[model samples]
Target: MIKIYSITVTTILLAVVSLISCSSEETSEKKQENLSTSPATANYAITPVDLRYVKLTDDFWLPVVKRVQEETIPYAIKKCEEEGRLHNFLIASGEMEGSVKGKMPFDDTDVYKIIEGASMTLISAPNPELEKELDRIITIIGKGQEDDGYLTTWRTINPKKPPAPWVNVVEGKRWESLTASHELYNAGHLYEAAYAHYKATGKTNFLNIAYKNADLIVKTFGDNEGQIAAVPGHQIIETGLIKLYALSGKEEYLKMARYFLDNRGRSEHHKLNDSYLSAAYSQDHLPVIEQDEVLGHAVRAMYMYAAMTDIAVLMKDADYENAVDKLWQNMVEKKIYLTGGLGARHEGEAFGDNYEL
Candidate 1:
């Protein structure tokens, strides 16, 4: 699976935020006292600085940012439009006729990711032209969304037929093949990108799409009656939901995120029938707090750790924090590659036994 390196991005974001403001010793002591009395009220240990407050003025990073603005963003947009990714969105909206037109089940995410990157660029330097282009993409994305808020172009285009042959076609119903369907994964990316756009532009156009889909998710899954009792085959949805919660301060979003995290490794929650995607492969063999070492797909493991860190700080959960601390130590001291790439071995694209790299 392709990983987005979210942990690295989040860490860098937090570091910049720290540089913008430094708390006094007395303020830190007061916060510590509050944590002891009411941890939930305590602020996140590290916070991401709003992009508006950051200006990329350094020589090295400034040119790189400018290149992405002048070259990379337009290039990626042109390629996506030329390659029929934009066409697929229209097809899903019934504006055109055909099956999905991509090799990967989650190909639509390429568009969403482009929008996210461009939106971030707009944050550092306001560009009306790029903002308009993003609006146009978001309009097409709105067309692709189902009335009920479903947005995966492939599955939305044709439920009975998947873009890739390996996807088990189970009556073409949504969520049937959690391990390969990638419906939830696509939604996760949409939510993430949409949130970024909202933060950058302060426009609700993209965010409304995210809100509708999130509401559907909140209604569809939980411990409540009539809700599905399963976790994502992929891990990033948990963090995506948490990001929404952080943005909107909605309890339902936070609860849904917690539901996904709390259910992992529990027998009653979702599990894959395939041996290859078995619990261990997805980091579902043991509860998050019980696992001390990383042992799954490298990106997925890091994404999950990122969520655990979010929960640890946002919710002030000690067990989750302790677990993440131990896991971080193991990765740094034992399994990490000399090149600094995660995943010590190629098999299963996961970590190997200690020092195996």
Candidate 2:
């Protein structure tokens, strides 16, 4: 069974404060002085302390992280194998003779997330066995990639037949249905996992896959002639690209991420999808900088907001910062649940109108 770690808000806040404090003896004092002068006008962003530097020893949170590292991680990996998540990779790579085996177009992300979680676990607790297993899994995943670096296994196995009926694939080609295809979403998770793996083991095996796929994405989408003008139906890719940019110092990756955000809600660039994939469903109803209220799938909205915050801090854009602030206030005051839960409407797994309970 999957074990959920129910971390309290106070515990999380304290952990964060402790981590920030550990950054430097004067970090907390400097932050306070900055807040006292101009609470929102800090010229620099806080640099996150690496997990290697911060050890979790408190009775409250250490157990939770241990549970994740010990029980949950192993359980998730076993479930993924049993559910054919691993086999899908081999099948796509032609190492196994079978069709895609999953219920979701984005099922590839299950493996990616597992790798990412395991990598994080390794950071705090070094395990040679786990590192070896990750290397094995990364190898299988790499085999599934197309020569050009596309790595969506289900699509690679059989683009004509999407794993789910809801995915609308008219052409049976890559990027045919950006809204439901989840191609970019898969890449996003892969990038995230790859980066984590790289950090944990100081390895480039998975990181190279991420970079190749990212390069393909950068070449595929843009305002340039012959390039497709579109945004992801779901979010997360923006943040993934931003992470890549931070690692590689690649301005193109950063530009690609900003382009995706800038083009959202601009109907002139591309028509939004219908039904659950509609503009509002993915927080594409308005440009990132102009979106004041939080709307859309709760997960999507949060990821978009995170990427927007990255943009605000990295680019020092006041407008983006303002929109994020406004949206946070709206969510806290009117949309968020009393228990801090989100997504009031289950049908779309989305946030409700203001004051909805």
* Candidate closest to the true structure, highest lDDT: 2
Model 2 CA lDDT for position 60: 61
Query: What local distance difference test score does each model get?
Result: 0.77, 0.79
Q: Lowest lDDT 10-mer window, candidate 1? A: 1-10
TM-score, every prediction: 0.87, 0.87
Candidate 1: deviation at residue 60, Å? Answer: 3.3
Candidate 1 collision pairs: none
Residue-level error in angstroms, candidate 2, position 209: 0.9
